[model samples]
Target: MSLLADNGKTSNCRPAFVCLLLFSLLQLPRPQYNLPFSVLALFLCGVVSLSLGQNDKAQRDRLIACLASLILVTALLQAMLGFVQALGLAPQTYGWVLFTPGASDVMGNFGQRNQLAQFLGWGAVSAAYLYATGRMGRAATGSAVLVLALMMSWTGARLPLAYGLGLALLAWFWHRRVPQDETVARMARVLAWSVLALALIQIFNQQIDSVLQAIGLPIHVQSGSDRLLDAGFGARRRIEWSKAWEVFLQHPWFGVGLGGYAWHSAWLEAYGGWPKVPESWLFTHSHNLIFQLLAETGLVGTLLVVGGLLCCLLPYFRRGEQTVDNLLLISIAMMLLGHSMFEYPLWYLPFLLMLVIICTLSPAKGWTVQLSGRFRQVLGVSAGVLALAYAATGILPYRQLIQNFTPRNENTLQASLDNAKRSLKLSELSRNPLWSWEADLGMVNYLQPDGIMRDLQLELAERVARYQPFPTVLIKLSILRALNGQAEPAKQALTMAIANYPDYTPVFQHELARYREPELKPLQEMASKAVKAGAAQGGATEAGRLAAVMTVAAPATRQPIF
Candidate 1:
């Protein structure tokens, strides 16, 4: 289909545009929170609307065919590599190729193989559709079968292989109901044979290999199954979920706000003894997205998110377009589920953008609108303008971060630190703090002891007065004061610090050791003498009583003043 024709009838445009805007917004270096997901739901709604529209059927079909071909080609290549490895041949690694490891024994690099296997899965779905639809040639069909077998053997990715088999079986069971074209029937036959061959090979090679090992003719090698055991591991997830529930209970309404997960977790750790509370253990999100949403955004926000997903899924499901939609839907579902196991994938702008694109491109229908030539031109210009604006916003902050941190720009670092301090002060005054308070602390450290002594001292005093005293900060303050000849005050501070945190015996000992220096002894003796003289002058008063106590406590070898 021509571009104009595709644009005219396809419901994809509205959702695609919205997704593009959201993607651009997320890519803006600042924190966007839920805007990306919100926009994505709207995009999905557009797709749903378009799918229900009467126009653009031909255009949508053509796009699906093209996407299927792309997926087939990708799968075919991956399968070929797998076959090469199965034959004990080393496949040429391309620099441009993104390789993720699958099974360590079958594919040496696990991460690279895993990525390849995921792509292969996508390919398998696409290829299955192509074969079932009669879009693939005989040669391509045969090649795809061989590749699929190789992929199954080499990668050992059970999910994709299982999915492929299921798709094939479903296709075969419903073959009679499909269109009566000769090409379609022949394609279906090919798919059935391929799936059957792959399943037999897997069963015989894997299941039969163990039995055959007794006879010394092992056909399949087993990779160690530690990962399989770990798959059933639920303890950590349960703990995280429980903790998230507690957080939700604490902040039931409006939740903790955006970017509050780590801080909240830290707070929870401090009070409740959760293991996830160290300086290094910075957890920005809950492992489960739904739980994370509930914790961070609260019940109301979670309802909106659930409602959004339902709204987007409604139209496509109602139309019974499950077969064609399965590939895209499964991909999204797996990715979302996979992220819940370890990561917050949506935080990565590129991944989020790709998700938006895939969700928008899939579903084949929803809100269709025809645009005039002038309007189309205007849309193009608007997209460009938005992209540029987003790029500019992202670049500025990134550039500033680099500029302030570079080794050669020492002056700039100091200036930046000063600005950060000013901003922090203003924030405290306005009661509206920015998220980057650590930036000020970083700047202070960068300036070191000699460069910012007065400022550091002032800041420490302010911090001690305002915030609850922490052991490390108190120790640092004591050392700073002692070095500046505030010995008595330093000792008093150290005493209080030690009393507050008795666990910090080493720090307290170190501080006392500093006061015992030969040079410091003369100063201490002079102070003692002064106290004794004051006691003689004001006998029996409170200050005189303390001075007399000091005089009596002085050691004989120290040579007390008359």
Candidate 2:
């Protein structure tokens, strides 16, 4: 119900009031009080974890061990999937999985190589923890760790290997400090196995492709493996980090707003002269949690979060002895924490939930909150029910939208249009209504007459731009303006796209080249001039380098602008 108050304005409630104050201090626009789905997940998971934390140590350990076993098993399965993909044997479109799983893209159902690698790293940690606690045999733990380590290497993400090395050293220290503890000794052995796997993979990566070729596998592992050879961090990450820093400087005290980085980054590229990322690349997060928080929440939110983390750690730091159990738990949680420094694994619900649970299990040095059993039950049930209810609210609209937008026979056009209307109406109940624009666009294009279609599309495009401001939105707006006999506005919009996405000049040319419509001739001419101007600047190759990181295949619109 609190989320219902987010109508693009600050609410009088405590959380909303705090958000309003933060936005005011940051000099950003009036804050929206909408609660994103992640917030609810975080709340519910925290409730569950805190409740678990209050349990007896034996009960808690049993639960933790079970959770760790689940993590290890999940990771092992994903690792096997990744290995299949790398071997060029994965079937396309298996069940819910999409994407061409070839050697260059070993996603393991996560849809991203980096994310797959990080999750596998977490699994490796779990396997170690399980072995150290005598829950798993040494042989099984060793096999799981080896497979996970090998798959992580094949994913071509260097950060996990680097993180593994650092943690391996820490494990060694723990083993040395507590030489008598078999748990520490076993964990150190697992860490050593991971390090050895990393080293073995590095040495044999170049030859593995040749051997695969000998076996007639169509794909070679060379593409992703080559990334491992380079020591420098990616250029795209550097540019993103740099832009995030500039945003921090602009609003250092507060921030643009929570979840504002992507839109603000788009706005900056279009009008604020910020260095543009690759075409179609929207930086949802800065790729670094610290930088993202600094850019989104600024110093105030950063301090609050960091200070809270420190307070949690202060208990461990002040302890007279750092027990191996505590260190092991911290190490397991550190898998996600270290990954957050390089990637946004926590953005995914499973990883975030796991992190919350692990942190809850970790012993914090502080006064304990001794809630009565009845109180704990009430709190957990209330939070879980609220989260479940909020989640269910989106299901109907999402289903309707999916059904409404599915490709249908021309005979069912009227039915599709009717369903689109119903879907849009249902979507109003959603806190995030941006998705309704798709149905609106579909209805406008199909139901509206030719005489008004262009005008309605223009209006819709403009409205979307107000919220999104992506380059494609600007280009679509330009195309619509040209189609509507407003050439100047069209050119202005095209100019904005050119300025923000010069690397996309090739894409613009490709799209505009199909402009057989007489009214769109000016748009084609403008694109040509922009291309030539970009080439004349002697930066074509330089611009192309960034585009190599990520480029859109084409515009996202269903109907071609031409």
Most accurate candidate by TM-score: 2
After superposition, the stretches of candidate 2 with alpha carbons farther than 4 Å from their true spots are 1-38, 101-104, 212-219, 222-225, 229-232, 270-279, 314-324, 367-372, 389-396, 403-463, 478-525, 532-562
Tens-place lDDT per residue, model 1, 231-341, is 434444554566677788888865665555654553343333333211222355766677777787677656655554444444344434445434344443454445444
Per-residue lDDT tens digits for candidate 2, residues 225-330, read: 4675664445556656666777899999877666677755654444454344445445567677778878887898777655555544445333333454555556
For residue 139, what is the lDDT in candidate 2? 88
Give the backbone clash total of model 2: 1
RMSD of each: 16.3, 8.4
Compute the lDDT for candidate 2: 0.62
lDDT, residue 157, candidate 2: 75
Every candidate's lDDT: 0.47, 0.62
